[model samples]
Target chain A: MGSSETFENELTQLLPRLRRFAFSLSRNGADADDLAQATIERALRSRGQWEPGSRLDSWLYRIMRNLWIDTARARGRKEKHEAPEEEAQFVGEDPRESMDASLELKRAMAAMNRLPDEQREIVALILVEGFGYREVSEMLDLPIGTVSSRLVRGRTALLEMLGGSADG
Target chain B: MVEEEKFFAWLDGELSPDEAARVEAAVAADPELSKMAAEHRSMAAGLRGAFGAVEAQPVPERLQAMLKGDGKVASLTDARSRRQARLAQPFWVQAAALAATLAIGVFAGSQLGGGQGSPIHPRDGKLVAAAGLEQALSTQLASAPANTGPRIGLTYRDTSGAICRTFEDRAASGLACREGGDWRIRSLFQGAEGQAADYRMASGGDPQLMEAVDASIDGEPFDAAQEKAAMERGWR
Candidate 1:
């Protein structure tokens, strides 16, 4: 296949993962949808900027994370010193309702909305999306130490917020 | 020797065996260290649940469209109307086959509220198959008596191992799987039948519906013999 065709197919194949990443990044479904769409548009518009040898997911993730930052900035401007925003919404409602319905799951999902922006990204990339710390470090272009530190800190905060003891 | 961060790394499988062994030995020798390890492990377990919330979401239609650009006819909107003229066949005209191919996630969307009563109802904040629709999915067969509400065309197991059936009534159609003794509607939409062959098109046949069928089905949809057998088996 031609390079552009390959890129399109590759990009298409990445939607589900990218959409999940968008869900973890944005505060809610509508915003995530918009962000995912804008990210795709931007990636396609600037297709030349992506180095073919590099990882496509990492590249797409950088675009999505930056777009999310831009969006959060815009939303902050609109809200104008409002309360701290909620974060990390699940895209559609009642996902996995049939299989397992536990209060722990609910608390866990709710806790995801409480992590700080940087920490939440680490949690999503590492704990949620199953990206290894090294991959997440590269994806976010941070030091490996920063990645592990953020994950540890995010977990501590989540445990505290959920009334979970580190000991238990 | 093992710090909290190292414990986190150890639990996440990021540590080399040498470092992991140190962490394990430290925990085995001290209650404080053991508690920390448990806490970190508990936190990791909870985070997995957070991932499930996103993974379980149906692929949004807009996202699906982004994947299939080049002006590919989306499963909804324009495709159904244009295809009806070409796809009209004697069985459809005689039985008044509604051109409803349940778009995977469209019913939950605002687009097909089209007008009047919505077919979906939310229970405990979850959108579920309801009322006449629920009864129809559980009891109706594709070759059931005519005018008997939504017709169930294909019975098969979804990718998730749930038994889901496709049904359409009037202009609305959807796929529903049995869960907790109730049908959990996975996909619902109205407009444009999919490209399934004539036999598969009736109960709620259309390309989008077929796509859903392919995604979820364990094997071929029941033929007359299988459908009859499935009906006899009682959708277990």
Candidate 2:
């Protein structure tokens, strides 16, 4: 198969996972989708640069992270003082589960939102996306030790936000 | 001899056999060490379980569109252009520009809110989970496995147009639901004592279960009252 076909094929297999990772990072569905689209575009454009035998997901993740950072930088230039208004529409809560699930998830997400961008990114990649420590180090272009230390700190911060004891 | 670092390594299952044996011996002999090890293990398990769920939940439809070539490129380009325009102003002007730009961007972004693309995927007649979220939300609930995670909660559209549930996932995830399909996270409490299997998504006949979640209205789910009533009255 041509490199184009090869890239497309590889991307097709990784699409769902990429989407999930992007969603975790952005939280907003639209932003996550955009990031994924941009990442795929960049990946496909630079398919030649992708070393053979390297993990495709990690490569895509690096590209997605770069795109996300770029978008954040651009968006940061115009950070508004006020909070964005929540959208109006169907806000039907699932009734199957007990009332606690929604409340707990909301609390967690809100706490997660308070984390610094870098720490939040690490948490999303490590905990949310289930990327390995080495892969996260590579994806974020950080040393392995730095990744581990940051994760420890981030997890501690997260625990505190969740109203849990941070020592564990 | 087991060092403090070995605790994290053992919890991560990265300890060498000899090192792991040493740690085990220490834990067996010492109460505090045992407690610490148990707590770490539980915390790790909870974090793993909690994060895993994010991926398992179906992608929302709006996200899907953003991934599509057209929507993303357009959005990026728009944001990029706006940024460039702000850069042209002087330092003092830049401050004012930033504020105005933010206002405009927020207003514009909000206007561009929600999923604009068609909800129905051409290939599948069922309304694609495009707007609020992408993947079928119902599938996440049904496909969740038994003994999967800590049961922090459960949610189902009750007979009163309200969705309600209570519990925590094995990861010590605690959340609650209000309206059917709407979720509100409550508290996230992690602990040292671990005593549960991980939560798993339910699974069976995928297609049938999905259909049931969509079609079956336990009670009037707010806006769908008319349709739900019609169904109850035997919609022809």
Candidate 3:
């Protein structure tokens, strides 16, 4: 098979994981799919920039992260006017699985969503995606110390949220 | 405080082996440290459980189709080369190929509901919208409630200045352009009947149908305002 074909196959194998990562970042299924779709388009357009032997998943994650940042910035500007309707529409599109999500998992995701963007992303990369501190630091262009600190804060906050509900 | 950071690093497997061993010893000796470690592990597992279900759900067909070079993101050069290859084929071969594709569409339409009930019918060697499809193309706006009959997707003016719209019913989807007040089937493909409503239009999954759209669309598609305006103008 041709190299681009091989690249597509490898990328296809990564779709499930990519979708999962996108969900963790966006905290909503519709936005996650949109983010994943945009990432795929961008990856295909710039496939030549990727060094074949390096980690494609990490590269794609970086691309997604950058795109999410840009989107989030734009959304921030429009959010005042658009937030209510957008939130209602997203509620309508919430995947059925979320309704069936275990109480613990739902609580966990809710707590994760409450985190500041920086902490949530760091927590997602290191804790959820199983990326190493160094790897996440490199991905976010942050120092290893920052990644660790944010992760600890995120984890603590998440546990605190879960702790209150579990005990109460 | 530093020891607390070390404990988290140990839990994450980020510490060197020697440091991990020391943290492990600390956790084994201190109930409080062990309890915190357990909580951290549980939280991670919960986070994984929360998001991992997305991986288990069927990957949307649109995404799978994209990797197969069927979506718009299929590189321009690839699309150009394919177009060139098609042009290289003789006229009869292309005509025969077109006939075969239309035949499949006819078969699929028949399977859906043949004769008067069929959404499409061959008239004078061209596919024309009929039955419920003709009604939808003439009256249904893309902004209309999606629960109704065959959903209209994009509305745009083709390069020929004729208005066109993409529609999907139960078994098939295709691009039809308004010609002489009848929606003429320019391209049709089978099997998008079961896809999510959002995906059908969002991905434009059927490549041949998308190619028809690409070849003829004058510019951007009609947005909600534009669609309503077009509908008001009777899609003139």
Candidate 4:
């Protein structure tokens, strides 16, 4: 197969994991799929930018994070003009309803969603995706110390939200 | 808090060997520290279990096909060129394209009240078609429909072989695909109360909705005969 073909195959293998990370970021299925799709489009269009030997997953994650930031900003601006009542109707819509996870797992996800964006991303990178602190730092372009601090705060907040549900 | 950070760093194995040994010793000797460590570990496990479910789903076929090269990637290139060509067209041509694609009709006053109850409901995070929308997708044909509820647009089989249809009601317009006995909404565009119309306009449709259709559509949208046959087969 050609080099581009090899790249496509490797990207296909990464889809499930890429989608999982997207779900962690977006906290909903529709948005998660959209983000994942956008990421693939970017990765394919700029395939030359990716260093062949470097981690494709890491590159993809960074692209997804940046895309998500852009999407969030756009959504924020759009929401500004909408009536608060219109937005309120969707506030009670639980994203977890779409997942087939256990109650405890759903609760955990809900708590994770409640975390501040910066900390939530760090916590997901460390605890869920299992990236090393330094790796996450580089991916997020923050110092290792800052990543650790955010992870600590995020974990603490998560524990409190879980509220002794897992204590036993 | 500094000490707590050290404990977490140790838990995550981020510390130097000597520091890890020190924290290990401290936790081994202290019950409170050990319990806190256990709680953190369990929480991490719970999160992994929760988020990991997504990895177990069948990757959407559109995503898989995009990697196969001829599907979305080719179309994206086509769309880019088409856009550039469009920019070069005369003003009237550009206006016609916009009007042809966005041909959302002016909804009647009676239809406007259809917003009181949603045609889709979120159940377990998935948008399932409900009430009139569900009935329309299941029974109404693009060729024939009673003048009520949402208007069904194109009926087609997606790349994944699911029966998908487009619908426009007073409140929103989107695509829905039949999956496991329910009409699962794939893409929905909530237009500002009656501004957007039919997405099946032969030319340019809503870009986002068209993107969703582009990703999922396998071949040509079902022609009248094929649609009738698919409907007869219960959209299986």
- The candidate maximizing DockQ is 4
* Best candidate (score: TM-score): 4
Sorting all predicted structures by TM-score, with the top scorer first, yields 4, 3, 1, 2
Better of 1 and 3 by TM-score: 3
Models 1 onward score TM values of 0.52, 0.47, 0.59, 0.60
DockQ of every predicted complex: 0.19, 0.06, 0.17, 0.32
Query: What does candidate 4's lDDT look like per residue over B163-189, in tens digits?
Result: 898877655668899988899988776
How much does each candidate deviate at the interface, measured as C-alpha RMSD after superposition? 13.6, 12.2, 12.0, 9.8
Q: Between the candidate structures 2 and 3, which one is better when assessed by lDDT?
A: 3
Among residues 3 or more apart in sequence or in different chains, the pairs in candidate 1 whose N, CA or C atoms overlap within 3 Å are: B80-B192, B158-B216, B194-B206, B194-B207, B195-B207
- Worst 10 contiguous positions by lDDT, candidate 4 chain B: B193-202
What is candidate 4's lDDT per residue for A1-168, written digit by digit as tens? 588888999999999999888777764554466578778878986899999999999999999888776655545554455422122112124442334544544465567667777898898889989999999999999999999999999999988877434542
Model 2 regions more than 4 Å off: A1-3, A73-77, A80-107, A163-168, B1-6, B27-40, B58-236
Better of 2 and 3 by TM-score: 3
Each prediction's RMSD to truth:
18.1, 20.0, 16.8, 15.7
Candidate 4, B-chain TM: 0.49
CA lDDT, every model vs. true structure: 0.63, 0.46, 0.70, 0.69
Error of 4 at B22 (Å): 0.4
